[model samples]
Target: MPGRLQHKAALITGAGSGIGLESSLLFASEGANVLLIDVNVQAAEKVQKLIAERYPNVKSAAIKADVSKESDIKAAVDKAVELFGRLDVMFNNAGIMHPEDDNALNTEERIWDLTMNINLKGVWWGCKYAILAMRNNPTDASKGLHTGGSIINTASFVAIMGAATPQLAYTASKGAVLAMTRELAMVHAREGIRLNSICPGPLKTPLLMDFLNTTEKRERRMVHLPMGRFGEAIEIAQGALFLASDESSYITGTDFAVDGGLSSCYVTATGEPTLPPPSSLA
Candidate 1:
């Protein structure tokens, strides 16, 4: 049998590492033609090569792009369309969280601006170009091309809940992403395009590990996880896979929380579920 995304085409930003790289591999494995966009050219190329070797039947490419630049994002999307004949999924996953991004009072102006630029503005650009491209896609099934596509933005658990360890700029940017995703999803709901955001909790990615280099720091962050551990990148990628495929056709304008139930926690880290003693039934 064919894969879930048998004939789809997807463009993934930040495709060089972590969640992005994992998703790129997963999407290709599921039979989607993928375009891997990243600032790290060599890293993207490496993954692209891996895809070529592992999934020779899958069409894929690695393109260098700094998501902070609108021109670069636009060009990358355009190139994907030119190469694949249509755009079926857009995964805007590039973002940053700096160790210096403390509370509002301590966060540097440069850091604040940089975080918003790449995280917030970058998502907007990706959505903008994707909407434009998908709107007039020559391959629309109605016009003999593919059906409407899915757009996934990488927000965070911080977007919905407050963090005492305040990476203020990161939180703010993600909050903005959630807001943008909702409005866009509603606006384009009737146009065959689906827009959604994935809010992830702390994950075992280099970005998070590097920020929490010390065991003390890592432990502090882990204490709040409902799963009692950091999530893996592939776990989050699997969520994206569902949204990108037709399985989630009716889902849009929503935030898919893939944080291992961390966002649902109230007081303590999650543990085994409690069950009533069986003697009462007798």
Candidate 2:
């Protein structure tokens, strides 16, 4: 049997590490020709090599492009089409969370701008180009590179909820991404291009763990996690795979929360006794 993303061409940003890296591998395994674009050329190349070795039939390429630059994004998207003859999925997963971004007051101008450039503006560019490429391509179910494909933006659960531990810049950028995804989905809904945002909860990625450098910092957020643990990058990648495949044909203009119930929890992580606690004992 053919894979879910068979014959599709996917262009993913930040494909060098973390969720982006995992998604690239998974997409290729599912029969998509993946274009792994990242600022780190060596890292991207390594992933491409690994994909080639593991899945010799899967076509993939490592493209060095900083999402913060619109020119680079355009070139990356174009290269995907050039390489695979069409574009089917666009995963705008590149983002940053600086240590300096404690809150709005503590967040420096430089940090805010940097985060928005990559996380917000970068997403915009990716969508713009991906839509343009997809709109023109005729959907061919037989070939598996369907017309007007899926665009998955990587937002965060922080976009939907306020956090006690604030990374104001990161939060703000993600919120913008969610809003953008909704509007873009609406604009292109009739045209057949589905736009969606994946709002991932705190995951065990280097980006989050490195920022939460201290055990105390990690524990502070852990109390809010209903799952009692962080999510894995592969988990988020699986969500991306669903959005990328034809399985989500009717899903668009919505945010898919791949969080560990952190966004829905009202109780504190303190494990304090509640009125319902007595029922649990019974």
Candidate 3:
């Protein structure tokens, strides 16, 4: 196996499938020990089996964690450190959008709370424990190593650009993710613990599918995408691999949008009106 992240240990939430799973497998393939965490214990165990079968001698484990709970977050991190000797990367990727997914004004209070608690606060707890665990690895800057580690939080293209289809709580939570990434980056930057985020566009994952199983909502959501298509979990995972590995050594407090350019594209700014760059004379 390659040493892109050799000897590094990672804990990824929501690693059952999608970006988290892709990243977990990729990281293992590239020579990093991986810890797959999820609320779905079966899913996590399955992923662990897959890694062991494929990588032969790769170091990896899976833990069941809600992510929204502090104790669960702590346990997951502890498991990684105990099994792999240290924590080098943390992917705060577990999330949920409200089932009702209404607009801001009309959104139900319960739904709002649930979405924010899981999507935003869940990420907060992950970062908190991961950073602390990472610091314990002892600085090894002399080796150009990520001894202080990195954190990649999952956000959305909605964090950068709002859409016509309103999932207000989801959008707001991602926006908060972007902010937290920057703040956390600054906080531990001197400690060499970098924090960044991935803002995906429309993804073809169980997470998104579960929300868009309704035909009406799915079509409405697709229409907003200029690509007229959905993005694959593998693509998002590749983006995460970059952020999680030494390749993004100097990159922090940034949001990588893997949304088929949805956030950067514009329809009306150039005025022909279908999806182009937003322009200004300034």
For 191-218, candidate 1 gives per-residue lDDT tens digits of 9899999988888889988888888888
TM-score of each: 0.92, 0.94, 0.90
Can you give the lDDT of residue 263 in candidate 3? 73
The weakest ten consecutive residues by lDDT in model 3 span: 273-282
Clashes of each: 4, 1, 3
User: Over the stretch 1-282, how does candidate 3's per-residue lDDT look in tens digits?
Assistant: 356877678899999877787888888887889989888889888888988988877798888889889999998899988898889899999988766877978889888889898899999999999989888885556645556888999999988988667789899999999999999999899987999999888887777888787788787766666666677777787788888788898998888888876776664122232534222111
Among these predictions, the greatest TM-score belongs to 2
Stretches of candidate 1 off by over 4 Å are 139-147, 269-282
Candidate 3 residue pairs in clash (backbone atoms < 3 Å): 266-275, 266-276, 267-275
TM-score of 2: 0.94
Output the TM-score of candidate 3. 0.90
Q: Scored by CA lDDT, what does every candidate get?
A: 0.88, 0.88, 0.83
lDDT of 2 at 220: 83
